[model samples]
Target: MVTPRLIVFTDRRQAARPLDEVVNRAIDGGARVFVLREDDLPAAERAELAARLGAMVAGAGGRLVLEEGPELRKCHGLADLVGAAEDGVDLATLSPIYPTRSKPGYGPPLGLAGLGRMALAVSIPVYALGGVDSPARVRDCLDQGAAGVAVMGAVMRADDPARFVKELLTA
Candidate 1:
């Protein structure tokens, strides 16, 4: 849809370093879309972080999407898919398309068929999220009709985020 081939999800708790530091590295590594998923922060704090991240992403000619907001560009889990278009969402991420330790307990994995089903159901671009850690998985998701893939641990925990992102983008 929007042509963002790779979206990096941020979780403060799961990060190995400061969120900004990790995100900056990712941006340098070719990540074009970033989703702020820190739900535990107070509203004001979250907004502040979003503003900061927005600036960073913009500097890299990328985009930033908040997990919670009235923003036109947004990311959503499968359960939130029903009214995404009505809510004015430009992009949505239907998650757990495969089993993932990064987002355990959300529900069962959607698999390829379910991913395709949801992708076809929504007019907005649907990104496959969860357990999409490899280049092959990225290709698989794209083949299944996903506009792209959203990842957490794959890039966040990587020793070389730039290289990891480059591999994903090239794949």
Candidate 2:
């Protein structure tokens, strides 16, 4: 039932540098957790990548939540969150707290109120997602009762991923 306060998700398509490099720098910048979202890779490739990142982070006392991996299940809405808890997931991600470029038309965008309600409605930990890039937004999510925050595109596209990690950690 332990979860880190920040979880950085990977999106290779938007990466400004190699994922390992970005993740390594993030780790160096104090990011202690990550979610491996490169699901497009074949099972073997994904497993290899996971093992590599897992080892790297493990040495730093960090960890990775693989997409659909046994460790964590990401939930996009309240119902999904409830179901995940019922199915034994300890934590999940709830999204679109603001408009995001990553999912252009995917949502009408739930604000902080939605995040609060969802967190209150579920027993398991919930991480706020979507448009949560800056320190202020990260603070806003925590204020609304999010257990932590999860981010992808912003860090993935950042020219200085380490600095990005440091900025978010300041929240």
Candidate 3:
């Protein structure tokens, strides 16, 4: 099974442009993986958005994973990762690999060392999420054994989302 090298999480509220516009530009820039994290919206609304984005991503040889989707499971720490792995999840995200504003008080920020340990502990593909806002950081995550780097505010808030994504993927 193939694993994404860069997974972008969407937060429409954080996007400087329309969600579809940003996603389209990212796709044009070679982004192939995305995650929909719009739990604040109504279920029907979220589902509709997911379906629309799924088609767009699919057209670009990519995929969109919904936060509440059953196909993939997301986890925070090693223990959760272990349990998710046992459940045969398609993939998982292990987060707060660094201090992040998005998750100000989610928990103590899990440093790179913690990320490494968690990545090794999980049998499934574990994506490094949170505070991966730069190319160097993205590379750090990969070096630490993450299957990919999952980002949210980076692309969402970038004035040039496409360029940022290209840089992140190449990094």
Candidate 4:
């Protein structure tokens, strides 16, 4: 089994680089999933990126999470996921949930108890995102019922991104 490794949340801020390179690096970094959260891009751009990313992740035997926008309500299985994030995603996530480089004044993090409630409410597996900065937080989320943690800065800003991911996988 893959041991449910880390997921990577790639947003519009990262669109400047070529999608192939970005996804390739993430795959090499032991990321088992990728959630494309590029809200600023037009539908065409988003779909284009999604198609490319989906191919890459699927080729590597990983899943690609595409935020369905308000369309999530229109989708069959995404409602629960949408609900969890609205509730206590961080709590569900274990520690810092948002990315460290996120815009200042992001909402407060949801601790373990809060996330546990979300886990109870939702059917699909939940992965903690946002300011996840430590290995301990990763362990905590797993213990608290999150499927895994998704990182942005922790891996993106590192010197050896793939190696950093390996460390995270082992951690």
Q: Estimate the overall C-alpha local distance difference test score of candidate 4.
A: 0.61
Between candidates 1 and 4, the one scoring higher on TM-score is 1
lDDT of 3: 0.87
**Candidate 2 local lDDT, 60-163, one digit each (tens):** 89888777776677667888889987887778888878889886665677899999998889888889989998999999999999999999999888889889
Candidate with maximal TM-score: 3
Model 3 reaches what TM-score against the true structure? 0.95
Q: Give a tens-digit lDDT track for model 4, residues 54-162.
A: 9888999997766553312111123445565565342223334433555334445566665656555665556666666578777776677777776776665555666
Report, for every candidate in turn, its global Cα lDDT versus the true structure.
0.82, 0.86, 0.87, 0.61
Off by over 4 Å in 2: none
Tens-place lDDT digits, model 3, residues 1-171: 368888889999999999999998888777898889988999899889999999999998898987877756777788889889898887888878888877777688788999999899878888888899999998999899998888888888888888999999899
Q: By TM-score, is 3 or 4 better?
A: 3
The Cα error of candidate 4 at residue 126, in Å, is 2.1
* Model 1 lDDT, residue 58, Cα: 90
TM-scores of the candidates in the order shown? 0.87, 0.94, 0.95, 0.69
- Over 4 Å off in model 3, which ranges? none
Q: Output the lDDT of residue 91, model 2.
A: 83
